[model samples]
Target: MSASAQGYVAAELARGGYQNVHDLLSQACATHPQRTAFSCGDDHLTYAELGSRADAFARYLRYHAGLQPGDRLALQLPNCLQYPIAVFGALKAGLVIVNTNPQYTAAEARHQFHDSGAKAILVLDRLLPLVRAVQADTELQQIILTSVDDLQQPIYESQEDGTLRFMQALRLGEQRSPVQREAGLDRLALLQYTGGTTGVSKGAMLTHRNLLANVLQTIELFDQPGLLEPEKDVRIAPLPLYHIMAFATNCLSSVGMGLHTVFIRDGRNLDETIGAMQRHPFSLLSGINTLFVGLMNHPEFRRIDFSHLKWATSGGAPLNSEVGRRWQALTGAPIREGFGLTEASPVVATGTQLSPYREGYIGQALIETELRTVDDEGNDVPPETPGELWLRGPQVMQGYWQRPDETAKVLTPDGWLKTGDIALLDADGFVKIVDRKKDMILVSGFNVFPNEIEDVLMQHPSVRECVAVGVPDARKGEAVKVFVSLKDDTVDERALLEHCRQYLTGYKMPSFLELRDELPKTAVGKLLRRQLRDEASAAAS
Candidate 1:
């Protein structure tokens, strides 16, 4: 888009009167009061109902829990009707939300709660045991438990163990007057934790304005003609809301655009997910490459209707060309792959419907966002040369919470946030990610990206999923290692190695190969390459 056109779109998006997430919710509720805002299975809520419940939860937090503005509250729940309610409620009460993963173990839960100094937490009933194990070590003063069927089941009173039921809190809030608060743009809205796969996890401090700007940016992208119908789109929400990508896409952006979202608590269940897709004439679908591959492999998935699909996006991982082409053949909608990280409100660039199938490219930067490919010294690199991507935009996080030393390593003195991925920016502003800076393998002083090796291995008919990592080698200093999960165990390892040798150079060829039943991945289906590297290192030691 041209500069003038970009500015005009930005002006139009700014008219939404968004000072924070609460403002977005308020605007949506007012504009589309009776529309179905969110639904899961048979449970659904209108815009008005969602607004009232969110306001009630906010009031209960103020008058009942006594949590002050800027205080932290960890929300540990899966994708249910109550997830968005808790998110909006926490933001409306002016509390900084910590989006906790419901799958966390006791130690993981304890570390986040204690580090964030959260006094309150909202957890699901199924995860109560894990919370109870870590409660004494953290600063939690109040625990609120919810159920998957909380909205469907009969209402109950608070328990005697000083725990409050999720339904009871809403009822209590209804009895009290609503607390009025409008958070400023600079106020912190969420402390989203990341970096767990690489090493220690830290919270990325995102402000209300950071999130609001990103939502507006995304809306501008989708506002293009033939991409998405504004306020009338139906989306299938298969990704977990705890991840940044899903939080911004489904919980905030889709909701802000007035799209009705269908939540899927268990995205792994192909039968259930396909059934949900069939139940609704969803216009927009969003997920990672693994999900698309799973759906394509399922016997019943191809029978579902996809006539209404206007947009299909893949994020949270690289989209394989083979997988993307097969998906397009089946669904008749090309898989537009985008790139993002947790620090930049999760979305930095995306592919539009106009140019959906640029091989290995992540389209252009968002309007009002500036991107630079820089060398190690912060100088701009030549066009099409891979370098670390530096981003300066309103959507970038403030810094890592309470870790200034660590934050200084990534964020520059001015405003640029250093993304750890190696990428190349073309003249037209299209970005093609090479790989993570840390994930690059150095063999005989040559840098090799794992994506290239994995892409080659993915072409093999027997390989279902594969990840490449660098392992120690006394002769070459470092060598490439590949771990793969096959379609079945009948395929010979020698044939796979021969295929790799035919496609890759001597240095890029895998020096070691291991077969596995499955590879480690994040909840969002991002391949955990760091985990494989760690495993290899431990085994070598």
Candidate 2:
């Protein structure tokens, strides 16, 4: 088969009349009004109810908050019943969504809020303090908060200096007409922030067309044999909705197909997540490698009935073959490994349960998405040769928001997004990711740059210099290990780690800290991260 024919699978599916996600939501609501669209514990919302609430929120944004179309609205909440309400509401109101991670500290929150220029934010009531800390420096004009129990327990707390309860906003919007605005497919829908080649965070400008295309691509794959059933499939939402992959798959695609999504507010709590699985005979589940391993390792996982589980999709990080085989042995369902990045609206390719599972290879490019492994000279490498992976598709983000120079570095003029990962494409189009070009560490599926860690460590007065490298781990696919050269004679690993804990998230935190005499450096005084990585690998071996 020719290289052009690699994406032939996409051509088999048709692009329907839906212009944007709003249209998709409208269609789902119209088709399955009574079906459960989203649920978290006892709190549930039907498609009709979800749509109505979204419309109400839209109305509030337009009339009460005085937000116009194309404005940015930040959503900083965990996986709960209110997540979809805020997301769909922002879309219906023609506002660009900035999906902010609730795990972000005040400083991290400040960067995203300031970068996106978000006018309004839908945050959790408990996380109001984090938002308040950065609100003064941002363009935020309105603050709407929601609690996990707000659906069961009415939260009418509002009128407190630019702050309002999520329920209150919904009630206010319910009084007014729903916001009506038509946006082109090219209009920006989301400002999904990502740490690109450089450690600095940049927003990927995802247009409505990009997200819609990726959703269609995923839906087409799910429609194949033994994958996803429409109304009958109940999926477990363990991954955070703030992440692009979860946002696309769990929130949009699953909801569009009328699949019941059972939300687990904290995926880290394997006990509750397993309990949730036992309660519902869920047919479909999606998560990263760490999540799969965590569940399989849990004692309660053996007690849960896997009779109804049809397919388990893995992404976020490299899927371990041993974990996959063990998962199948326990659950009787092989884990299908998929590949994606935040830049591509997250879903580029996925392995299918219908076929024999490959250990390391991510399945062929999704229908209509083209993939190629290119050399340093920007020429395509031969089949099975490792090279930088490049992708082109309707799902690719427009570019990095407010960073044209940074955008040009990765994206080619012809539309191909140069993924900084080294991969090999077989003649059959299966992509095997061999290595990453950038020194980014994948800690349990989250991207952690070495530079980010070094920067944080540099802030400490006792630290002279530091280099962070990913070390092999038994549990997490990779763990952060920082080697430090101290300025003072005394060495305090705890103090250095404590300083890092203040700036970095849990996943990004270094699990191992080693005080070293010196780290490898280039002739030009540049830190040789790869050398440190090689040393770690050698030591492990």
Candidate 3:
């Protein structure tokens, strides 16, 4: 690591008030006791109530469930009141949190549970069948099932199948006092699973210091003049909290700043999500490209008042420039895009309120973070040159959990993380993420980035969603193939190809175009290029 980077990180941590993630909640409770901290559907929790309930859940883990410090606890629930309670509670009990996506299949669930060696899990009641299917193959000792309305409904103890209800556990937990456990800043706080798109998902081991530093870094960047206000801004959180972006931003950073976060249980359900926005008059919104497109297309979206919306953020995937422009036209707030991976506590750079809107740029690096673009030989590239992006900062993860071989591949011995993204840094220090190094398509010996193609395609009025992938070609080594889902049946393949030819060069233009009802995306709304590539290769074979 660079000496300057280390000095900056040390200084920031020294002045940062809290030591652990849960400590942020404690301070928020003390400072903003009566303010609403989190809400879902019709249920909400004041800062004080959230803290007390978290303490109760912590007591239940320690005294009732016999969970001890350093134990792993998997939280497998959607956006609900129990999600935040379980997260804060698990952290308070000195347990490492494994944020499991509730959409995981039985095999995926089994692999993560067995790999993390999770001793307990707080799962949604509807997902119990999948958990039960995989329970015998893993190290899970305790099962706590919860419904969407667990906090509002009456408690029911169902120990018949060796499972405990969420409300019942909280009720039993209230009988005991809070557990007093000392958590060092260096101790592991969360095992966030990532990299599933490439292969098997690996858990990124984030320490208390890593998460806290990111929270402070984000707060420093966004806390400009006339920007974010504490205890006043209402944030609409439609993304799943299990993802590292939402976990670091909404669950930790937003709470630390005393923001009232309204959770949308199912972001895919546009009606419910739009309804939440209409009801809350949220000042901040965070989402990816697909969510933004879906919201803007919804008939009810324009009905909601956007005057209260101060700023919006986009991540998880590249924000199409067309989408950003349309969003700004519809709502007065500009969609400031950010860049990060799960390893850097998920946020390395973001656009601030004062920053100018630049197409394909992800703003500047966060406070105390160092960013560089390195060539294939690991030498620094000049400004405006594209190379693999490298980051070194306090927010970087300790390492991947129990995967030293995998850890050695990404993290350097000198503490710099080799982000697999190809990016360009201009003379002004603004970053434009070219593409993921692995995702770069080599067509006729020239690098064709999917983002460049997708960006051009998205500008077409009829193109609702589009993705580009490299397919096997007999003449050239590989060829560009485009998949698109349109707004209507007005345009055919010839028209789309003609549209692409107008903007894209001959080499960058699509050799083949396929139209579909919709393209496949991840739960977080990232386009699945690998899946499409695999299908294309299979068809050719």
Q: For candidate 3, what is the TM-score?
A: 0.82
Model 2, stretches more than 4 Å misplaced?
Answer: 1-15, 225-227
Worst 10 residues of 3 by lDDT: 1-10
Q: Where does candidate 3 stray beyond 4 Å?
A: 1-9, 196-198, 440-541
Please give each candidate's TM-score: 0.81, 0.96, 0.82
Superposed Cα deviation of residue 199, candidate 1 (Å): 0.9
lDDT (Cα, tens digit) per residue for candidate 2, span 375-475: 99999989999999999988899899999999999999999999999999988888899999988999877889888889899998889889899987757
After the best TM-score superposition of candidate 1, give how far the Cα of residue 433 lies from its true spot, in angstroms. 0.5
Q: Compared to the true structure, candidate 1 yields what TM-score?
A: 0.81
Please write out the lDDT profile of model 3 over residues 335-449, one tens digit for every residue. 9998888999989988867887678898988878889899998999999999999998889999989989889988999999998888999877789987667775655333467
What are the lDDT scores of the predictions, listed in order? 0.83, 0.86, 0.84
Ranking by lDDT: 2, 3, 1
User: RMSD, each candidate, Å?
Assistant: 10.3, 2.1, 10.4
Q: Please tell me which model should have the higher TM-score, number 1 or number 2.
A: 2
